[model samples]
Target: MNVCIEDCTPRSASVFSRSNLRLESTLQELSLYDFQVDLDQVGMVLAKMFETNPTIPGVILNHDSQFIGMISRRRFLEHLSRPYGRELFLPRSIRALYKLSQVELLILPGDTLIVDAARLAIMRSPEQIYEPIIVQISETDYRLLDTQQLLIFQSFIHQLATELLQEQTQSQLMQTEKLASLGQMVAGVAHEIRNPVGCIVGNTHCLTQYYEDIMQLINAYEQELITPRPSIEELKEDIDWEFLKNDGLQMLKSIQVSSEQLKHLVNSLRTFSHMENKQRRETDIHECLDSTLIILKNRLKVGIDVIKSYGNLPKFLGYSGLLSQVFMNLLANAIDALEETANHSHNTAKIWISTHVADSCPSQLRSLIIPPKNNPEYPQNTESSEDPLTPNSQYIVIRITDNGPGIPKEIQNRIFDNFFTTKSAEKGTGLGLAISHQIIYEKHGGCLHLLSTPGIGTEFEIVLPLI
Candidate 1:
């Protein structure tokens, strides 16, 4: 039976277009042969139909208008080639021929995933592997799906998967370059600003000492006076010298404190922006979190309440820069969510950042959020480690939670998808969470999980191996 490759119109029709082809596409979506013939029909009738339509893989057979089974052109032709086969089957009801030619039938539901159907189709016996599949559309309706068409769909899907992965890899590389450039720019700015801040801090310290020395001299002058100096007393009273001495010292101390804080902020920015490093090292997770928070303090100061719960964790051997990127993205998202919700309600906008070490995967973090490769039910990347919480395996768990109008359940699953976001254009590029996911999932062989309740809150959990 020649299944005409050209008649598989779905491919040319853009049914499998790069933008539309999905692993979840079903058998019914492809071209299905709906021609049916009665089991009692003469062989000549079915033979005539096959001759007229070579594209039809097979015909569904029914007994008295009731579907019974199916017979492919290949099998029909072979049965007719037997000794005196035409004279024997062509004259009699096709039921005799059907009974004799019956082979294993692969029946699948119409809604079966194409990938799954292909798997089942290939699992057929070698003899029946070329047979058309019986697609059960309903109780009494059936259609024929060519084995060749299915294999082609599977091949196309495989190609599309490879292309998608390549595109994602390229995008990630480009994003990495952007982050490195941004980091370099920030480092330069931080260096430039630290110089002046350093001067101010030093000058303020010296000025404080000078002021103390002048105050001590004034006191000595007062102690050394043999008689009341009326002119100096009148000058001190007119100028309010006592207030100046006390307030000037306090002002100098305040300048020193402000300058110190400026230095701390500069350091935080420097640490958070070190995205140019090419290697991983022992990184302090708490420091990374603190640096990210400080970088976002401007946004957080609006109305956000930050709650921190840091647990004992060991230094992790990982890309600190990339991890900080993830932290920044998550924290920024939390702050954004809280801010977006601030005007709509009276609730205190809050972001909760907590970290801890666990010997086992948390019950909630047994969760996986990675999109599927070919099967929509399972994620291939989530299994990077055989047992995420094997007996001796320890992991660092960091949770960034926010009290805001949480993400809708419908879009929660797709939040990590490339270029998927709920923010406006000016506020979002849709790449933040996706890049964060790649950093954690690919760079460190870790897991990123999302837990959200609509109208309640949202939490993003990052689980990294302690090693």
Candidate 2:
């Protein structure tokens, strides 16, 4: 046997009242099935009703008590003013004036919430959004809801949602700015420390050579079987000359190695953070990729393989530092994808970087690049370029691909959207692809595109014009 359990706890009187109030609120409470005319009525019937009841904006219709359609006062006026329309239609029946092009009457049950009625009304066509929604009260009774009141209700909700989204965006930007400031501080400190570390490395090298020369002289003197003076012997024993000779050299070598490593790290940090220059210059983009790869070497050494297919191309004019940051972001993300792939299989994870030149049209390229959402802070460039990318123009396209779980098609259009991420909160800030998109399209006047298949892989293509 099944036993049923029910909640017997008492609820507050105010809560019960609120629930009762919500149940009683519906479209049926608005009005009744009046202000209607018959389809057989003369066309002048609508004009006469409008004159008699000037407050009513529209009238519904019925044929043998079957709902047919509705006509608004505004439309009736326009029809009457048309040349020869009054003479042609005013004396005719309502069926003669009715046209098939009119918007279909939207119907809803009387039990529908006002909010739901408003939502259904706005979902209609551009012309129909302002038309009254028919609320059915009974089998043969109905009511017309004013679209103006419904729209006003929706406008308030829309305004509230917009304000909330604005607040969220503002918070995201504040976090990004804090991170940016921290990165700048770190870069400044690294730059200041590099010079002193270089000096220490150079001095250690000299000391290592000097110590080696002293050891050589001592060995030569000892090989001749010349007895050291008592004072010298005591000094050697106190200093543990034999241990010092081996360990002292090892210490200097360790220091030198560590110093070199530190310098490389400092250089990598500088490369990743050095996007301050906004000027375009003639520089090798391959070198930028190489530097980025060097910085990511530690992460790539475990199970990842990077394959580069470089092509001979001219030095394109662009911001080297900004381009380097783009490469760094792409390569880093590729490595992350490969690492994720490695966790599931023993297969060798790989990333492919290739470059080539091709012909492209600016108009066609513009369609591929997603325009930025309306952001008042960063206004978009509305003017067309004088030197547009004609079909004859040569474009250098750089492709970065990774053999990993690809991005889903649903989110392909949003990969470059600001503050959008597939990664966890601790792993990403969601600005890498957004910044890269801006650097390529807004700054370099290039295009960024992505192609992906879920089971296959993901590829990003960056196209920059040669001219």
Best by TM-score: 1
For each candidate in turn, the TM-score is: 0.75, 0.64
Poorest 10 consecutive residues by lDDT, candidate 1: 1-10
Residue pairs of candidate 2 with colliding backbone atoms: none
Q: What is the C-alpha lDDT of each candidate?
A: 0.81, 0.73
lDDT of 2 by residue, 249-304 (tens): 89988988888877777776776666555577786778777777877888989878
Which segments of candidate 1 are over 4 A away from where they belong?
Answer: 1-25, 63-65, 109-112, 136-141, 208-255, 275-283, 311-319, 356-397, 405-456, 460-467
Model 2 C-alpha RMSD vs. true structure (Å) is 10.1
Model 2, runs deviating above 4 Å: 1-103, 106-130, 134-146, 211-219, 226-254, 275-278, 311-316, 355-396
**Distance from true position, residue 306, model 1, in Å?**
0.6
Q: Global lDDT for candidate 2?
A: 0.73
| Model 1 per-residue lDDT tens digits across residues 69-153 | 9999999999899999999988888889899989989999999998899999999889999999999999987888889988888
Name the TM-score of candidate 1: 0.75
